[model samples]
Target: MKIAFTAPMKPLDDPVPSGDRTMGRLIVQALELGGHEVRVASRFRTWVKEGGDAAILTRETEGLSEADRITREWEAEGYRPDVFLTYHLYHKAPDWIGPALADRFNLPYAIIEASRAPKRQTGPWALGFRAADDALARADVVGALHHADAECLGAVLQRDRLKILLPFLDTLPFETAADLVIKHHKAPKLLAAGMMREGDKTRSYEVLADALSRCMDLDWSLTVIGDGPNRAYVESLFPPERTSFLGALPPEQMPQHYAAHDLFVWPAIREAFGFVFLEAQASGLGVVAGSTFGVPDIVQDGKTGLLAPEGDAEAFAAHLRALIPDPARIEQLGEEAARHIRFRHTLEMGCARLNAFLETALDNRWQRSTAPRRPHQSSGQPL
Candidate 1:
């Protein structure tokens, strides 16, 4: 299958330390592993950072034109794709290209993790949100990673058309260090890795710091691996002497950090299934995180990791403290966590699910071609 892939959030090669960019790259890698011909359709991003009527209108106009131009350029070269695949779609970074290009070229369209909301249709992001809705409305199959996203989008689109794909990555890199990582098992070490940015990330850091401070009886050392605009602020959240900031390390060098730790701790406040959580699990490290968003889908409470209620510092501290007294339980959870990821959330598993979804999409698209074209119908509308 010749798949034209694009991500409106960020280009796969973009030099930005974002989870969205990482997810985009993973999707491409998964597609290629599934034996599909992948094409970088367009690198033109449709990310709307700020919200305002005038800003959105201008963005919508320009973004739409840019998408069309890319399609026109392809037409000139007599090249057409079998399907248009977009990664990561939300109100902030709406997909303004895939749907328009697919419509132009008369091909199947699929969106991976495209979240939708009714209220967004009439706000400052009115145009971008609608464009995103249109794409979801037009999608032959919508791949959803989070259960919450699926539930919200199912209200607007066919629940049957929404296929669940567990977020995944190539864990082989980390798997290789399993033997060496086991040796770093000594000491009550905690690992926290993510972009130390404002909003949810900062909130998570603040809550975690507070939670750790509450664990006064527990003896632990924290190693933070990330750097962002709010690095200074995030660093200040933790105890300076005990918390060692490792700065940003490349993905290739991350397994050592994961292996060296006994527990992966993070207060996942409204996270859409953090990839780092999985990476840590893959390295056979137990987790201590907040139970919210898509986190439950990954971290099995009381099994692979002990989860505290989202934003509950005392509970989080208590949970960590509870685990610290019993090192055997933590070790068991880490072992189980690694096995869990290997069996369910590896690259091969992710590719198989995606290939199945795409096959279904292609089959449906072929079936639709036999009938007369109908006007685009969207089950979701602006409230």
Candidate 2:
């Protein structure tokens, strides 16, 4: 099958390092692994951070123009795709070209990680919300990455059209690092990784600092990774002597860091199933994160890691205090964490799930096109 892929939130080859970009690359890899010819259809991003209806209109016009150009080129070359797959459709970054191209080519349309926010229907993002809603209605199949997204997507799509596509990655590097690295820390070494920015990220840092402050009596050292505009403020939240900042590092250098540490800690306020949690667990590190949104989907409480109530610094601190004294329990959790990721979350598993989704979409499209049509009573036309 030839699949035309698009990521409206971020381009697959974007130089900036982010979770969105990483997921986009992984989707392409998964499709290729399934023996499908995948091509990135467009790089025209439709994300609008802060804008009125005018901003949405401008993007809509540009998106239509881009779709026209691609249609012409593909027709000239006689290249027709069997399916149109899009990743990350939301009010902030609704897909504008995928639906148009899919209609023009008469192909099955599918979306991954499609979120619907009914509250945005009347706000400043009304146009974008409507556009996203229309796209969701037209999708033959929608893949939800976590349980929370699946619930919200169910409100607008049929139950059979919605599938749970668990978050996954290539865990070979982390698994190799876990097998090779031996931790020998004087005090239990803790690790946390996230971009330091305003909004929810800085709030997570604040909660982490407060939680760590309450556990000062315990002997532990924390290493923080990532850098952003709020680095200075985020650094100020933690004690200089107890925390070591590694700044921002490349993706290739992260597995060793995860393996060197004994635990991964983060407040995870409003996080959307963090990839860092998966990476940390893949490297045999037990996690302690706030139970919010999709955090529970990846990290099983009491099985792979401990989850505190969201934003409760006291509960988070108590969990840390309990684990710091018991190295045996920490090791046990880490072992379980590694095993969980190996069995349930991997590139191969993700590829199989994606292939199944494509097959379902194609079958749905074929049934709809071949179904019997009734004539309209008023105009004598096929309805």
Candidate 3:
């Protein structure tokens, strides 16, 4: 199957520390692995540490228009994809054009990782939400990353049509210095990676700090990875010497950072699906994330790792402290986490499922289109 993929708000090829970028790359790879041709339709841009290339996507209508030009160019080449795929369609870039294009080409329309909130009404964003609703209603399949997201569009989505496709990991390639898990230590190193925003995450971090303060009797260190606008402020609060800030590293080098630590902690405010937890679990580390959004679906509360009370830093710290003494549990849970993710959450599994589902959907469509037309009948008699 030829898939026409589009990510309107953020370009599919955008270089950023984002779940959307991760999912976009994963889906493309999955489709390719499933033996499907994927043509990503979005404004192309190459990100530089200095800045982005203006020639790629200018900050004006002209930039978006150029994207549309490329979409048309593909359509002109008699290459209408069998299915039109769009991910992360929100108020920014609603599927005004993508859906219409799908309809014109007689292809199945599909959406991945879309969300809406009723409280976000009373603004231009409302218009975008309504449009997203329409696009979702028309879609033949909607792959929701979170159960809450599936509930958000419950009015239109068929239960069977909505598949819970969790966030996937390609598994970063890295060389470990040593089996840190084997090393005997009095203190356990807790690792976390995410943006340092002041919302729920910052508050959670503060709570974790407070919890850790309460457990000063225990030996432990924290490593906060990734950097953002709030870096200076978060760093000011949790200095590097105590809570080392490693900023961001390339995806390939991320696993080594995780392997160097024993556990992963991320108590987000409200996450749709925390891909970082997936990455952590993939790195053979036990995860302790909050119990909100789609986290439970990712981290098995007890088997894979633990889930603290949402925003309860005390609970997080208690859980973290408990694992410090239990080297056997860490080894057991870490291996369990890796096996669970390797089997269920790999990009290969996701893509294989996606390919099978699309092929089934296409086959259903063909059968419906070519089925024999029955003679018109009224009540109990044929006309």
Candidate 4:
């Protein structure tokens, strides 16, 4: 099967290292691993940083033009995609190309990680909201990475159309590193990795700094890996002596860092299924993360890692205090964490799941198209 894929939020090849970009790349990799030919249909991003009616209209117009160009190019090359798939669709980054291309090519349309925000329909992002909703309604299948998203998506889509595609990663490197690295740290080394930006990331950092501060008497050292515009603010939040900043490190170098740490601590405020949690657990590091959206789906509380209530520094601190004293418990959790990722969240598992999802989407499209249509009671139009 040939798949025409696009990530409207962030292009897969975007230089910025983020969880969104990582997930986009992994999805393409998963498709290719299933023996399907996947082509990135476009890199024309439709994301509006600060919402405005004009911005949304401009993106919509540009997106339509790009869609037309792609259709013509594909026709000339005799390449017709069997499926048009998109990842990460929301009001802020609604997909404009996928729906147009799918309709033009008469292909099965599917979306992964799509969020529906009804409240945005009357705001500055009204156009984007409507566009995203239309795309969702037209999709043959919608993959929900988080259960919370599934609830809202279910309102606009059939229950069967919404499939649970949990967050996953290529855990081989982290797992291998976990097996090879020997822990020799003097104090329990806690690691946190996230871009030091404002909003949720910075809030998480602030929560983390406060939580760690409470455990001052405990034997632990903190290392943070990431850099952003608000680095100074994030740095000031943590103690200079206890916390060491590694700045931003490439993805290739993360496995070793994960392996070096005993615990992965992050106040994942409103995090949508953190990839770092998966990587940390895969590297045999017990996680202490805030129990936010989709965090529980990956990090099994009291099993692979411990979760504190979202934004509660006291609860997060308590978890840290408990784990710091007991290296045995941390090691046990780490072992289970590694196994949890291997059994359920590896690339191979994701590939198989994605292949099934695509097949289901194609089947659903065929069924819907062939089903008999009912006449509308008011106007006698096909329903």
Task: Candidate 2: list runs displaced more than 4 Å.
Answer: 371-383
What are the per-model numbers of colliding residue pairs? 0, 0, 0, 0
- Residue-wise lDDT of candidate 3 within 47-110, one digit each (tens)? 2112223321232234346446756786578555677778776544466555666666655677
Q: Per-residue CA lDDT of candidate 4, range 84-195, in tens?
A: 8999999988887999988877677999999887899888999999999989988999999989899889889998799999978998889788778899877899999999
Q: Which stretches of model 3 miss by more than 4 angstroms? A: 44-71, 172-182, 239-241, 360-383
Clashing pairs in 1: none
Q: Which residue pairs clash in candidate 3? A: none
Q: lDDT per model, in order?
A: 0.82, 0.88, 0.69, 0.89
Candidate 2 clashes between residue pairs 3 or more apart in a chain or in different chains: none
Better of 1 and 2 by lDDT: 2
lDDT of 2 by residue, 165-238 (tens): 88788999999988898777768999999999989989999999999999899999999998999999999999
Question: How close is every model to the real structure, measured as TM-score?
Answer: 0.93, 0.95, 0.84, 0.96
Model 3 misses residue 135 by how many Å?
1.1
Best by lDDT: 4
375: Cα error in model 4, Å = 27
